[model samples]
Target: MAGETAPLGPARVCRLPPPGGAEERVTELCTALLSGFQRYEQRIRARQYMDGLLRTQGRKSIANIATTLGAPGDEHRLRHFVSRSHWAVETVRQALTAFLEESGPASAWVALPVSIPKGGEHTVGVSRHLSPDRSRVVNGQRALGVWYASERVVAPVSWRLELSDDPPTAGRSTGGGPAQEGVPAPQDCLRELLDDVRRWGTPGPPVLMDGRGEDESGRLAALFAGQVPAAARINGWTPLAGGHRTVHGRQAVAALDALSPTLRTHRRGRDGSPDRRPVATATATVRLAGTGNRSRQENRRLTLLGVWHEARREPGELWLTNMDESAADSLLSSARLLHAVGDGWRTRGAAVGLRDYEGRSLHGWHRHMTLASGAYVMSAISSSSDQARSSGRSP
Candidate 1:
């Protein structure tokens, strides 16, 4: 039962300076995001909560944050503001999306799957899920993060929590029903995220994600067909047909294996020396297994890209893309953006308490994530500004 315990109670209050530099810029960002709260007090409380998140160290539980802000008595008020307030999370997300758009042009829209390990089942959407590496099982909340990524800056603007069908049997009541019924599939959740981006009227950038299994690849290929440009890694054994070379049917690995490397490149090693592992890339025109009722030839056509290492006999990586101009370097560049999202989440995201919320309500989770995302954006912007100024360039 040690790892199954909930977070601890509040501690004594302690005074800490606000999150270092860029206070004024972060304040401006908070003002833009919290504008939807009609009450002035609500807006102020939201600002305080963000400040607490930014300033708190270690596990950013509400109690710890409250203590760090030297307002231990306001803990309950902050809790209620996050869990029980009627603030619209979507409005803040839309505003954040607008803010990111105005900041600069995004290179790619990356979908990042975040798995937060939790100790208790009472948290909303907490369930047993496989770790990202699939090495072991973890009890946690699974959330899909939509990130707006560019060459210099990356920030998460929206999030969707994956709710479990089983109800928690701890201190929470479910009225003898599941915690939430008819939970959407992963693809559906992504579609909903895309819908939000579309509704926000932002430019549609190429979508990127790690290789999905066969079933998901098929569904995703159909979803992106004629809808938007996308580049998703697919499993090597995924079936495909109808290449430009009149191939009848073959697995992705086989299709890519038949082609020679069209491009080759090298990268710097960890110690600043050139890495010995040479990378090669190749491409073939192919189509996913299922294409539903679309007559346009271009809609059904997709490029099958294979990335190989000098040491491997077969292609080491396989990807599928529907972009109009699928250059090898362009697709490779898009794939690199996924790393930016990962790095941002691990560093700035953790620092801002992205996974530190201990509440159990759906609304509370959304509110917390929205604010945490704002915190990440502020930190990223601040860091970018610092780097630009140090490099003698305008931010």
Candidate 2:
């Protein structure tokens, strides 16, 4: 449905807490989410850890959490809970999905690969990579997350770690071996994750990726062929022509940079400021490279949505989608939903110390990230619930 949103059902209401009873509500939430733990002690430990993690003043290190909660054995027990506990992460995964379903239906799925810079080499899967934030090379571990997003919330539905072929220093091992044994490439991890998402049903929204994954359109298109529609940002100068004339061949940057501003739009300013800018958009049918069929080099026509900002002279942003112009425009034009994915990352980092994981084991990395995702989902739900109640609407 282009330019249209399905009407939401009666909003689900979160049971309110009594006056001065906010902690009880949070505790209740924690218990429900931690019920996935197989052992009763595991459940208790998980709850205690979450409570302190949220209340802890600084980085969510094991020592800080242990000291803040005054738990026995300081960081030892807490460390065991995350790095050595036998609780199955899959159980928590299912619980999180169930809670998200109860919150509301999702409008889209965003796949973001997060890069966490690490100072030590002992961290599992830590490898040298070009850090997008740092603008230079850095040692880091990369994790890919597929998040479900609606107008009110965005939460991860699936996650995978990118493994490098290089062997880890002593005491460090790859989190999990790839299917084939040797270290798996990042693309391999993405393919497997996308396949897993395909099996996850309900609120099945289209998937969106950033410029990095968009460059691998061939494999991505083949993987999702005729099942789920996909959209991605492409660099300018991607061999698009305005007309069928053979001489019209030109890069996306050349084609879009020449157009004048045709639309004006406003975006919320950072730091509570207001900002406005002149913007323009144009739609065209372009043959994106790598979208050709394998049987032969047959090009598949895709709707190309181009957005240009007067300030950024280069290609502002180019979106390639299988939907018609109206549908593609409706889905990606505002671009706010895209930015919300980054917001999810920021919230996790500030509130939960998303980058402070201390374990070096493969399972430990997965376990920590899984719990972090749960914490983030709950926070989003609570925030939206408060907003709904304040507005005199159920949520």
Candidate 3:
């Protein structure tokens, strides 16, 4: 709610002229997103649903959207299209990935975990889970969102719902039921997302993952060993094979504690201020232990990175990377980009109804998310165009 803007409403929808207005842009985006749809009516329905998402005032329920757009007898039709439609969600996502690649190449791929709260018991993948910040337990749907991110923009391109181990409900075939057997670990979900990205034929970019509270650095690094470069936040207690005097394995924090810290300054501020913050950094060559059953000779060599703020007594953050020659500044920049993606999700994502779905089926939730992602991309591109116009340059 902090970064939200007033709704556009029906009045604004009515005032936009044809050929070059925001409505026209929405039409173009929908056409591109759903080009694989076989039926013309499906495309039209998708456009209408997306329009409602962008212009409707309050919650983006099907009934609310239909009523806000002044479309009589459309609530049922839209619900059917979302819940029981035969179209493939993967097709729409592929088109979206293509559109984004053509718009501008992304600098990195990010895996973002989100928690959507629910009041009822029947929604797909609904269960008690930790909040995004891991503050407290809440009843919600846990989802992994894969994003293509750059300094200028960030948008979710694919999503995966984490199924709960709760017993299957009677007659439910779509989601949170017998269709999926058990819940996958967060690292498994991230691996599946990366596989999807690779299958889309997009350029492999360095992956940035949030491993703040978990000690999955070895497993996460193994995911990108021979595929693409990666940097993941590592727990201080993660075991390492090198960077210590003893032959025994040592913790990441202990390895850094044995080394000298290098002083560095960060120029980019979170609030866009020019002030610089001096940071102490250190690095050591190490190998992550317990990745797999590989022998010591087969284990991949990794760089253990440690950073300490002037105010903190110990290292504030630890990271593990497969990029052996990566500089400390570059890895820190990637960390900043990770924060930017999170901010974009909290603000732009909320505005486009990222968590407003009211469906009970797995396919329905995915369809709604696909449309919401399109709306987010369109809004981001439109805002960028407006800024370019105001600055007397090309969009």
Task: Score every model by TM-score.
Answer: 0.79, 0.75, 0.80
- Which 10 consecutive positions of candidate 2 have the poorest summed lDDT? 1-10
Each model's RMSD to truth, in Å? Answer: 8.9, 7.4, 7.2
Residue 211 in model 3: lDDT: 53
Which model is ahead, 2 or 3, in terms of TM-score? 3
For candidate 3, report its TM-score.
Answer: 0.80
Supply the global lDDT for candidate 3.
0.66
Error of 2 at 198 (Å): 3.5
Tell me, by TM-score, which candidate is best: 3
Badly placed stretches (over 4 Å) of model 3 are 1-27, 119-121, 167-183, 214-222, 239-251, 257-275, 290-298, 388-395
In candidate 2, what are the lDDT values of residues 100-154, reduced to their tens digit?
Answer: 5554655666767677877344577787776543446777877777776666566
Hey, what RMSD does candidate 1 come out at?
A: 8.9
The sequence of per-residue lDDT tens digits that candidate 3 reaches over residues 3-72 is 0111111111111112364446556667789796788888888888887888887678888889988995
Write the candidate numbers in order of decreasing TM-score: 3, 1, 2
